[model samples]
Target: MFDTPQSTRSGATAPPPASHPTLPADRPGPHSKRLGYIAVIATFGGLLFGYDTGVINGALEPMRDDLGLTATMEGFVVSVLIFGAAIGALIGGRMADSQGRRRNILMLATIFMVGTLGCVLAPTWETLGVFRFILGLAVGGASATVPVYLAEMAPVERRGSIVTRNEVMIVSGQFAAFVINAIIFNIWGEHDSVWRYMLLVALAPAIGLFVGMLRMPESPRWLSSQGRDDEALEVLRQVRSPERAEAELAEVHALALEEKESQTGGWSDLATPWIRRLIIVGIGIGVFSQLSGINVIMYYGTQLLENAGFSSNGAILANTANGLFSVLGVTVGILMMNKFNRRAMIITGYTLTTTFHLLVGIFALAMPDNSLKPYVIMGLVIGFVFSMQALIGPLTWLLLSEIFPLKIRSFAMGVSVFTLWIANSIVAFGFPPTVSALGISSTFFVFAALGVLAIIFMWRMAPETRGRTLEQFEDDFRIQHS
Candidate 1:
């Protein structure tokens, strides 16, 4: 086991590989300035990812009305996209490896555009589902590709901040979706077909990503891996000082040579007990991440609030608060990252979120039929979202990145995130009928119970990975598990 570069939006646990050469620090030269511009352009993929997923929060109601969807159909409509995402994520990771990161991203952008156009013009729910599945392919692809592109392109010292840009853009994009939904719903509240306009919002960034990436250079590390040292050095020099670019190429070249000896592992690696255990841990982390019920709010928050007591317009507007608090949570989470132990943050996060979930269920069931009941429940749900995004949400990705050894790191991360999406699909698909049969109060009670289970899982199974260097952590992990 060896260290690999992996981190969450917080950029925690982002130490460069010990086996690689030291990278140059970020400089204030023209090349560096241009590099910042390039990063901004590239992370448009993340922005599109957030909007496409979130626009459905408010759009689902209108979409169902226009398409005349049944409750079960509603569940499948939402779940199918996630199922596609699961497969897309795995395929996208491999594409990133075999194809250049830049090429994969460019292709994903086109898919995003096509998916957006299809959804906007979809005449039937079945047609909508097919296009949504196509969009999921793009979403999952961007998820797997964009961060790697950023990490590889960024200066070693600035990788944390640069890679983190995509995450910030993601949350901000969700907020944008909510805001746009509210505005559109308010101005055109009478229209039954307003949802088409909501989904159309994603097309802009998808176009931006495609256009902007045409000017971007290929990843230097990837170039080196493919035996194109001259091309790699040229790309690096455009983004770094000439001397730094030359030095980094030698290191990248050396690392590329080392990789040939330990080529990425396959199914046989899973036969090894230690690797298998960590793989289970990786998948478990993904499972717990979704079982926390965060996406229930993300995908269904507008409808959830409508059930709680808000009017159609009020619900659409109020859901913006969830999006807003998410941005806030990610902000605070980033600040807390440097200070808190990741495992401790996760445990405490689960506890707080569980408490909030319990409160939401309790208030919904026990509160008198009054306006106050909705407000009280709304506050509690916000608490859940904030605590989730602040700790468990980002930490889920971080832990996935941290747990796997270098040899199979990409494979494991892809598998785990795929599980996360499947878990998400299961929850998303079941949520509507569960609410129909059990009501929102009981449904939340179910989530609360699941939250308790997630807490237990983290306590017993999660690794304490804070403060230690990645090599030491992986070594200790291997020995302890063995």
Candidate 2:
């Protein structure tokens, strides 16, 4: 068993805590305001992530017409970004680990800008798909890195809320896309190429993230891992209260020093029992989060509305409600993250979302040809959005950020989110065809069944990370291995 600063299962000497110099009573150190600034900047990556992915929902119709896309081709276009995101999550995690979190996000900003421009300017379907994949790289990178950055930087007590703020932004971005799509489509709905304007909206935020992150401090936990404790402490001083900063740094320093003896930040480390178990849980969180079928609503809300018998314009406009409530749900999620148990919230969300899915499916099946089906389906869709964003959506990203040990946090997160993207890709690619074959009722029923399985997994496997330090979680896992 490895020794840690805290008492081990095998009764070893607990290392003494680090000494910190006291400051004057009048001198206040860092506060939540600075942290909030950092969060705002970092979550821009999330915002861009949301807008880029969500833009496709409304743009797909115009894109299909302009590009003469078959149903298969449209699905391919939508799913390709997810497939690229899978690759991005994998690569971005490793990059964040080796290159530092701040540096990686800056890089992602550049990629977002270039990829967005490429997509906006693409002259052919092949080119658009390729650029979307490029944008996927930025999206995946942001997904893996931003939450880790926020989680590592945030105080333990407030970590859930702070990290999950990115979810709020992500949904907010999607909301913005829906609103923009509605306005743009209303004005230019007759034009086959109006989608280009929608795609261009993301470019400004990419630039903002790139510039804003330049002034932000590096993640103290990451610096600690790199043997830059002094730098880490300084960064902590910028974001946390003086006492809290010292305490957090103390924990980070201890872990960093202990792990210094033997580096542990790669795929090979997964061979050990505890690390393997942790990653499996991580993978489960990632997979089940997507399996909740939230993205079906996200990526195909307009199409789903149209399928339910709304006209094209009616469907696009109705999606605005989806976007609005998603923002509301995530806002509620941000408020509740600090108050609720992570596992309980996720389970509750999955259960409710699954029920909603079943209801939507059953309703659609019962009234498959009724004139009222569209309105009823719209209400159910709104219910699904509320259920998902408030719980499963925010909590998924929160848990993924909090679950892994710092040593392998980024790498493990990459794999977990990679799994998420894969599940997402499968759902995205399959949904078009599935809906085509089985109709709305059966499609949602399939999602509802998956949601049932997600609840069981959350109940049995997911950890409670509500009130613990990164080092505390690491020590607990190490003790389990011992």
TM-score for each of the candidates: 0.85, 0.92
Write down the TM-score for model 2.
0.92
lDDT (tens digit, per residue) of candidate 1 on 337-406: 5455566778888898888988988888888889787888889999999999887776775566456654
Instruction: Give the residue spans of candidate 1 off by over 4 A.
Output: 1-35, 155-158, 189-192, 233-255, 401-407, 459-482
lDDT of each candidate versus the true structure: 0.78, 0.86
Q: Mind giving the per-residue lDDT tens digits that candidate 2 earns over 246-312?
A: 8778878888888777666887887778889889999999998888888888888888999998997
Superposition error at 166 for model 2 (Å):
0.3
